[model samples]
Target chain A: EAGVTQFPSHSVIEKGQTVTLRCDPISGHDNLYWYRRVMGKEIKFLLHFVKESKQDESGMPNNRFLAERTGGTYSTLKVQPAELEDSGVYFCASSPIDTYGYTFGSGTRLTVV
Target chain B: GIQVEQSPPDLILQEGANSTLRCNFSDSVNNLQWFHQNPWGQLINLFYIPSGTKQNGRLSATTVATERYSLLYISSSQTTDSGVYFCAVNFNKFYFGSGTKLNVKP
Candidate 1:
C-alpha cells in the first residue's frame, strides 16, 4: 500500500499570495491530519479530519488558513495571503481509526518570502 | 493542551554504541508514538506504544503511561540513525515534543 502522499514537495511564493497543499492519504484510512514544523522547531498539529468531516481543527493558526477533506478521500490546506511566518514543512499523516499509528508523508516545504 | 519534553535535546555518539532517549508528557494520553525524521525530512514511524513495551530490530520503546513518560532505546547505533527523534502524544489532537537530534558518527 502506498504511504501518505504530499504534492509539490517544495513551494515558494511571495507573501500575501495564496498556496494550496494537497495530501492523499492511504486507501481506506479515514483519519487524516495536518501538521507543520516552522524553522526546525517542534512540529505542531494544524487540524484533523475524520473522513469528510473536520474532527478537530483547534490548531489551525488563523482565519487565513482553510482545510477541507472532500468525500473523505483526500485533503487540501489553503493558506490565503500567506505570511512570512507561515513558511515551514507541512506534513500529512493518516491512520486507521481502530489503530493509532500514523504514517506520515515526506512533507511539503513551503516558503513564503 | 499537553506539554511534552524530550531529554538531552541533542546527542552525539560513535557508531555501534548504545543510547537512550526520554520523553515526558504532562498529561495522560490516548496515543503515544515515536518517529524518526531523516535528513530528507521524512517522518518514519518507529513505534506506537501507548503503553507497555515493544521492540523492532535494534530499536525498542517503553511507554509507562501511568507515569506519563516514555523511553526509546537504540542498540548498535549506525550513521543511518542520525536524525531527529520526535515523541508525539495524542488525546484529542496530537502534540509533539521538541525532538532529540542524534548524530551517530561512523
Candidate 2:
C-alpha cells in the first residue's frame, strides 16, 4: 500500500507570501496528524484530524495557518503571509484508530526568504 | 506541556560498532515511539515501545515508563545508520526530543 504522501517536496517563497502543503493519508486510516520541525529543532505537533472532523487543533501556532481535511482522505495546510520563521519541514502522518505505529510522509521542506 | 530530553545530543561511531541513545520525559505518557530520519529527511518509525522492550534486526529499544526514560540500541552500526534518531512521547499530544545526530564512519 502507498504510504502517507506529501506534495511539493520542497518549497521556496518570499516572506509575506502564501503557500499550501498537501498530504494524502493512507487509505482507511481515520487519524491524520501534522507536525513541523524548525531547523535544528524537535518536531512539534500542529494539529490532528479524525475523519473529516478536527479532533484537536490546539497545537496550531497562530491564526495565519489553516488546515482542512476534505472527505477525510487528504489534508491541506495553508500558511498566509508566511514569515521567515515558518521555514522548516512539515510532515504528515496517519494511523488507524487503536494502532500503535504511525506512518509518516517524506516531508515538505519549506523555505521562506 | 511536558518536557522531553535526549542525550548525548550527538554520537559518532565506526562501522561495526555499537551505541546507545537515551530519552527522558517529564510526565506520564500513553505512547512512546522511536523514529529514524534518514539523510533524505524521511521519518521512519522504528518502534512503538510504550513500555518494556522490543527488538527488530540490528536495532532494539527499551522503555521504562515508570522511570520516564527510554533507550535505543544500535548494534553493528553501519554507515547507513548515520542520521537523526528521535524519541516522541504522547499523553494527549506528541512531544519530541531534540534527537541524537549519529555519524557512522566506514
Cα lDDT tens digits for candidate 1, A31-80: 99999999899999999999999988988999999999999999999999
Q: Model 2: which docking level applies? A: medium
Summarize candidate 1's per-residue lDDT along B9-52 as a digit string, tens digits: 99999999999999999999999999999997888899989999
DockQ for all models, in order? 0.78, 0.73
Computed on alpha carbons, the lDDT of every model, listed in order, comes to: 0.95, 0.94
User: After superposition, which runs of candidate 1 have C-alpha atoms over 4 Å from their true positions?
Assistant: none
lDDT tens readout by residue for model 2, B10-73: 8999899999999999999988999999987888899999999999999999999999999999
Q: What is the TM-score of chain A in candidate 1?
A: 0.98
Q: Which ten residues in a row have the lowest lDDT in candidate 1 chain A?
A: A96-105
Best by DockQ: 1
In TM-score terms, candidate 1 sits at: 0.95
> Docking quality tier of candidate 1?
medium
Task: Please tell me the interface RMSD, in Å, for model 2.
Answer: 1.3
Pairs of colliding residues, candidate 2? none
